[model samples]
Target: MSALELVLLLVLVTDPFGNLPLVLAALGRLDAAAYRRAVVRESLFAFGVLLVLGWGGAGLLQAFGITQPALYIGGGVILFLLSLRMIYGNAQGAFDDGYAADPLLVPIAVPAIAGPAAIATVILLRTQQAVPLSQLVLGLLCALLITLATFLPGRRIAAWLGPRGVNAMEKLTGLLLNLIAVNMMLEGVRRFLG
Candidate 1:
């Protein structure tokens, strides 16, 4: 993939829209102000997690004797499962109900934003690429900004999208994720057989 393609794929994999449910779920209980805060926090935290992965994850994996094929196999599985959740799981609105009484750090910041799929992607991608610390920081920030922009205004965004738009977006994202999953799985299989 070209550099731009890689970046776009990264964005697709990161999937700010896909993250909406988890974000809303985690902050759904809070008032608007608190909800906004939680959104910002989750996005920033996600950025931090990605930045660390981009900068140091590959080296750490290598130190532990991890191989590219292994990463492809493992990471692909994680990504597949995560993307399946995005595709076949609950209605998008379901996530907004649980956050009022719970902590935003758990359901929101974790698997929602910085989940295993993300960590594995970072680790796997970091193998073929080594982002400069500064570039990694910038990339993470850009993703966070996107997440923040989408999430903080979810109600309005949801309204703007209406049912039609949301459904279309979800389907498109799912399609893209399926393609990504297939590619990852193929990469793994190829390396395993090579």
Candidate 2:
């Protein structure tokens, strides 16, 4: 894949737009300054987690003797399921509002930004795609930056887009993700057969 494609894929998996509602809900109680601080902090934390996973994922897979084909298939399945959820389910309703007034890093950082789908995508990009580590890291950084940019003004963006607009955008992203997932699966099947 080209560098742009890699970055786009990373952005899609990170899915800042799709996760906006969750982030807003999680950080709703905080004041303006606290909200900005939490968003930046949690985003940084997520970046660190994903960076580690991207660097070590291949070694971890090799340790387990997991093949590329398996990773491709498994990752594709996971992405497909996540896309389905994005398309059909209520993103906000999926999680509970049980967070404290000043949330730290549970929902917003881990699962919201660097969730399983995002983690899987990073691993796949590191292992399955032939992109160099440097390029992958750069792409990851760019994607995260884009995510952070979206999140910084999330409330206003959400307001402008409104509920229906946000939902439509999420569904559109989900549709694109579904295509990518299928292609990944196909590539895996071809590699296995060959």
Candidate 3:
């Protein structure tokens, strides 16, 4: 896939727009400055995690005896399941809300921002495509940057989009993700059969 496609997919899976309410709730008690700082810090931390997985996840998979086909199929299945949640509007409750008051990283950085779906998708792209490491890194950075931008002004965006609008976008993105998941699975099956 092209760098643009990778970045777009990454952005969709990251789903910052959809997670606006969650972030707001987690950091709601904080002052404006603290909120901004938390947003930047947590996003950067999440980016660090994704970068690590994108860079070394293949070796980790190999160490675990996972083949490329298995990675593709697994990632595709996970993404597909996530998309189903999105499409059915059940994704709003899909993540844990057990974040502590004025949370820093646990829910925001780990599961919300760099969740399993995002991590799996990045690892899958890095392994499945012959895209250069530099390009993959660039794509991830670009996507994360967009996610950060959305998060910084998350409240305003959420106000503009509202809950219903965000849900609509989530469903649309979910449909696109479902299509990508099917393609990934089909490609994996073809490669495995060969």
Candidate 4:
């Protein structure tokens, strides 16, 4: 894939726009300055996690004797399920229950930013696409920068978009994800048959 395609895939899996409400809920109790700090901190933490996974995930897969086709099919299935949830599920209340008073990184960074789908995509890019480490790092950086930009002004954007608008956008993102997932699966099947 081209660098732009890699970045776009990373951004789609990151799903920053869809996770705006969750981020706001996680940091809602903090002051403005604290909120900004948390956003930056959590984003960094997420980047670190994704970087580690992207670099080391291939080794782990090899250790388990997993093949490229298997990884592609599994990743596609996971993304497909996530897209269905994004399209039809009630994501607004994702973090409504069992959240810390002063959240650190559990809800926002891990699942919201560097979730399973994102992690899987990073690994797929590294292994399936054989993206160079430098290019992968650059693509990840670009994607996370876009996510961070979205998060910094999350509240204002949320207000401007309104709940309904946000929901609409999430569904649209979901539709895109579904197409990507199907393509991934098709590639996997082709590889397996070949």
Q: Residue-wise lDDT of candidate 1 within 36-94, one digit each (tens)?
A: 77777767777677777777897798789988878887887877776776677643443
lDDT of 4: 0.87
Query: In every candidate, how many clashes are there?
Result: 1, 0, 0, 0
Residue pair clashes in candidate 3: none
Backbone clash total for model 4 is: 0
lDDT of 1 at 83: 70
Model 1 ranges with Cα > 4 A deviation: 1-3, 91-102
Model 1 global lDDT (CA atoms, 0 to 1):
0.69
- Alpha-carbon lDDT, every model: 0.69, 0.86, 0.81, 0.87
lDDT tens digits, residue span 161-191, model 3: 8878877877887888888888878877887
TM-score for each candidate, following the candidate numbering: 0.84, 0.95, 0.92, 0.95
Write model 2 residue lDDT over 1-194, tens digit each, in one string. 89899899999988888888888888888888998998999989887888899999889898999898888888889889888989998677766768886677878788877888888888888887767889988998998789889999999999999999888988988889899899888888999999
The number of residue pairs in model 1 that clash at the backbone is 1
The ten-residue window of minimal lDDT in model 4 covers 90-99
lDDT sort, best first? 4, 2, 3, 1
Q: In model 4, what lDDT does residue 80 have?
A: 96
